[model samples]
Target: MISTSPRATSVAGEPDAMSAREVLDLARSQQAAEDAAAARKLEAAARWADLHPPQSRHHAASFTLDGIEHEEAIAGDGCPTVAEFCIAELGTVLGISTTAAKRLIGHALELRHRLPRLWAAVHAGCVPAWRARLVAEATIHATPALTPASVAWIDAQVTPFAAKVGPAQLDRLVAEAIARQHPAEPVDPDDPHPACPDGRHVTIDADQVGFGGTTSVAAQLDLADALDLDHALQTGAAELKALGSTESLGARRAMALGHLARRQLALDLASATRLAADTDLAGQPTSLPAARALEFHLHFSAGLAGGLEIDHLGRMDEGQRLMVLDLVKSWCGDSHTKITVKPVIDLNTELTAPGYQPTGRQREQIALRDRTCVFPWCSQPARRCDLDHTVPFDHHAACDDPAQPGATTTSNLGALCRRHHRLKTHGRWQVSQPASGVFRWTSPHGHTYRRDSTGTTRVDSDPDPPAPPNRSSRAA
Candidate 1:
């Protein structure tokens, strides 16, 4: 007999091998299982949100749901309030980042409370959870905010087509709903982000720097500004070619953007001089603007083909390592870059601090030692994370007191992303540091994880005593 259980892996219980038709049937069953799993994820997220009511007294966002007012700790046009650190833990458990988990939870809550018809379709399995979540997210984030009647109207419009709707169709439906809600301000269904002054934006995703030392750049600017930048890039690319740079136009344009960032182009334009000739770009124009100090995080081991992580640009492969060295040499040697020397930090050296705040040198050593957030599977750069004392700092205790704990020192410090740090502070989790750069974390649910210089690992899951009540997280 073929097991109908969702967890069953076999297509035929008695078979040595499945037939072709049975194999195809198994694929269909897997699809159904995936849909069921997606539904469960949403349900679990919604339940988690329900378990964590907003605790901050500082929020101004209040909305009514089921005749009860909810003071949202996050965006509060009309969503249920949730505890600040709740999303991060859920995100970590789900192998996603906090922001992504928050969006998933928000979509789930919006579907459950505001868009009942679509929500019903999802639970009935007529609409996939992904499709319904998309509709929910669109309605929840619509500008001018939808009235309850408008939302109900949207629910009715989408529920029938929920299974097949795409973002383009969803955008049109939301725009139509917006128009119906406000007769005075008609919305163009075709125009998503209207060409309003407020809509012009330049956004950077610093977290997305790839190992190839490149980042994704996006911008929507005024027509004149856009044209001006294009012209500047063209000029810079032309100048690079003139100076014998053989890189592609795209690469040259990238370098041009860097020049703009360093005020190199600005200074030249201000002087009203053409690109100077000094054999290469090194000889170009005026002296390079004062540059930020560069810190190279390099590792050396045998023919071991060690690793290197550059600031801002991220990791560069050794085969393409000239990409980093050449880029640095171009900036420093060609661009007349300024070099400031600082003593190298010995990662083995442990330092002490007399106060709760770690010294700058101490922070650098810790950053170098950990290199990334001290959380299981978390890759957030340590330099960007908060220096947390495993023993929470107590302002009441004297630093020199023999009995006092929570001293700020290298041995006591590890880096954690803000959400994880807030989770530790307010999510009723516990952490202990047995050695410098070695930490053990205990989740509220009792799973223990160890983080060290090598990486993070889950050591065990022993039942922990019940955790304390949730507390409000301090604002980042």
Candidate 2:
């Protein structure tokens, strides 16, 4: 027989004892009450600006909290503005750091001035304060030159949908709205200069030394220079792979980058010619020979070739694309190097492969389409990830599924980084590709996340929530 406590006996005898459902209902009721209280607190904080008035130099306010006396000083002309006073007062009252308090005050100011609808929603307890804050922050970041009219427009567009979507989706909607409003300037052919006045510079910093007398170096370089160096490292890494290096791709690439640097330094030292030919000789020894050939890839949509549209990465403008093409043509003409253009097609009808492994051509197309890992929040390049099937290949095969056969096609495959791949395989995360290059991910908690070429977003329920406004058009 199991021993029972007097409390258990009393609970068993009591008719008022709560059932599982009753307990859950009571807990939910408590949560709703707490949420309402929290919303009221946020509303009060947001209204602090209206409640407190700036004080003049001659008029000061002193307050005593706990045991310490604090004085509020003037911010301008020996007076404290409402914002400054709020920050100081809130920091002390909330027991938060001054920086955090200042941020809180800034958020309050933004809500009051820029996001009236969201503020109203939060005050009514219809929208969570955190979600409202997210919308406000996203709008502020996306539209740096925000005006009263623009803020009102953003509020109108976002307020209706903000309560229905998660933070990630709200962020994307705000970003898309901003992009539509402020399309990038058309690329100019004559503007071929670094964005920064200072040309690229590289500096190495000393990091911790490791075992075997190995030293670690940290360096920062400009984007273009860094990309060039990375490309060289990739080439070197490919060579190492051909020579049968046992190291992983990431490790090999690291070694290859260092090797390339050492090789360049050795070549520079061994040259017989003076560093400046004119300094050693009466005049320049001879015109320098043509520079070495350089090869790089550029991928863009056919429709974007003539239009002033941003590239897939959103980093290259139309003018930059034209500059790149012009430079490539000039280099090829001077060096007599052949240029090959290959088209990447998304095959929805063609089922050329039956096995679980994707064909080499299919892999290339998938890499080009994805550009980066398909996992949520992961920015790892597609080249470095494994192509994962949305459905378990073996499970499909075992079900005697001859109609589609779960063929290794583009629609069924996605590139996932190693970490995420394991998470999906063994963890509670589930993924499904409802359309080509579109992924829907379900978490253990039942929340869903969607990802496409643009970015990832967490949704409430809709599988294909009305596609966020078209980025190509204005006033979307």
User: In TM-score terms, which candidate is top?
Assistant: 1
Q: In angstroms, how far off is 168's CA in candidate 2?
A: 1.7
Stretches of candidate 2 above 4 Å error?
1-20, 23-27, 51-86, 186-226, 232-248, 251-476
Task: Tell me which residue pairs clash in candidate 1.
Answer: none
Per-prediction TM-score to the true structure, in the order listed: 0.72, 0.38
Residues 286-340 of candidate 2 have per-residue lDDT tens digits of 4333334333334443344687664333222111122344443454664323455
Q: Candidate 1, TM-score vs. the true structure?
A: 0.72
* Model 2, C-alpha of 330: deviation from truth (Å): 48
lDDT of 1: 0.69
Clashes of each: 0, 5
RMSD to native for every prediction? Answer: 9.2, 26.4
Alpha-carbon local distance difference test for all models: 0.69, 0.59
